[model samples]
Target: MNWKDIPGLDGVESPGLLIDADAVQQNIDRMIEIVGGPDHVDRLFPHVKTHKIPEITRMQVDAGITKFKAATLSEAQMAATAGAREVLIAHQLVGPKVDRLATLIDDFPNTQFAVLVDDPHAADAINQKCGDAENPLDAYIDIDCGMHRTGILLGNPSDALRAHLDSLSGLRYAGLHVYDGHLHDPDLQVRTEKVKEILGKVARHEQQHPSPRVIVGGSPTFGIWAAETSWHCSPGTTLLWDFGYGNAHPDLPMTVAAALISRVISKPGEGKICIDLGHKSISAEMPLEKRFQFPDLPDAQPIGQSEEHLVLQTPNAASLHVGDIVIAIPRHICPTVALHSHATVVRGGRVTGERWRVTARDR
Candidate 1:
């Protein structure tokens, strides 16, 4: 989109992260609407790892989000400080991270903290630590429904592992947590079918040994899980959607909340101009076309990128000159948000004086 079209970024410097508060609120409301509103918002454990800012967490909490899932100790700390009723560190913490988490549990007594455990050895170590400190820890077996990454397989062997973990001291066995990020089909029905397949496995597991909760979904299939089942849904990218999710799933009613404000720095050749933004400004994880897209400059195509320069080849290149600002929406908002240290907050289509720290960026 054009710089003029985006609110609160009239005079902002180039290569900056601009966040629309109104758009974020709309995304949150959309999630709530999908998950059955306030009474069931707790079932939506929206991951805070997407936006590490405590202010955003507060906005979510004020909007009736009671549970959160974070991938780092820093994000979990922010969630706990935001007065979340429960926070799950969905990643395994090792070395210093473990100690920091222990401190977090002690410091934030009001927030019940949990961690994902796939290895019995790590569970033993954590159990030893928490048992020594006399502070019991809540643990969930990260079940691997399909993704071969961390987590025990969802069958017989897992039952034995769950029983072993429950027997361990200072480690309370909660339900299961699965991140089905691989289920990203353009067709909503295909996504829903995959969710149902996973849900069936989850149902059988719950029946054999009922845990207090089971958190599933990872942005793509959150709504599917919500529709077919009552389990907790964990969708982070919906908060600050990008072209990747929005373009793939048009049915999900979410707005683009995060955008990169950049300026043209040079006009080197015919039909070509370079922007201040590059791989450093946005996420490089996606494919070339999906990295970042300029909605307003539809003819402007990202030809190449480096650390600090995004070369654009467009027919309208001659219409632009040096110092012309443009807005770019990331194809993947989560990692793109991590690339910045601060976010420029805009409210009601007006720029606010406040700048929010991507508090957990370093962590």
Candidate 2:
């Protein structure tokens, strides 16, 4: 359906988000094809954190996705409620919210739940809680490949800690969770080599333990991940597509499916055009100036941005005026999406429909 076919495009407000459903579907199909063929459905577990909306998750499920990778308990719950049979909490579940994890485990009885643990203390807590339950909880050893953010070091895959957890009757050793956050590096060659090296270490660890039911890998390293390294690939941004990934591989099947639609709120000076979207609406973490592919206006540059404003400078800024709507593709999709509540699904230059409740907003 085209954007003009939607019910509320004319009267709807600006400084909002627009999602191209057609583009999104194409992306899903492309990624599925890349991982293997239709028969390899279990091999692709799209991360739900990218497009937190359940409707989108359902779409992915209908497309033969049984497994999902979520960053939080909320995301896991959302995916479960939306019909995801298997869900992986790609991060550690700690703190007083342990009850929440238990509640989810009780609620989604048929669903398989697994959480990543890099420390023995965290694993003990999870094991203690699950020990009392009838069904055991699945746990993965998150390895710190290169991104020193969450996982255990390569040399110390926390084997001793994993063994400790194995001794507990409540927790089952699922597999490895290796995410190369650094692989999205600007240099394609460097990123590819790093991913290969990291996955090689994971391969070695897997050989030693040989019994993990699931081997998972996150990040948009689809082009780099060896076909045999991972049993399932969890790529979030690859589904939605974004300016950051677009910059590195222009020909990638995924398009900028979502864009921050804003109107020219002000024209401060010659060659300077300001919009109403800023850090609050669009993500300032990646910065649009460093990322955006403006085929329509090649010379336009994001000079500065604030909480609710975007300053753009260009030689042809004189052509722009107030009330003119401008669609700014975000540098990063995850955080940029969190800033808005809903997204207008568009196609062929018109609003075809609307997707409400960008769901995974809660901390």
- Sliding window of 10 residues with minimal summed lDDT for model 2: 1-10
Q: How well is each residue in 1-363 modelled by candidate 2, as lDDT tens digits? A: 333234456555778877877788888888787777688767887788888888788888999988988888888988998899999888888886666888888889878888888888888888777545457788888877777888887554567767877887888888777777766666757766777777676677667766565454555576566364546677788778887778776545676677766778999999999988778887766645764444455788888888888888888789988977666677788887888888777755566655567877775
Compare the candidates by lDDT and give the number of the best one.
1
Segments of candidate 1 deviating more than 4 angstroms: 1-3, 132-135
TM-score of each: 0.96, 0.91
By TM-score, how accurate is candidate 2? 0.91
lDDT tens readout by residue for model 1, 242-296: 8888889897888888888898999989999999998888889877776877877
lDDT of 2 at 268: 93
User: What C-alpha lDDT do the candidate models reach, one value each?
Assistant: 0.84, 0.75
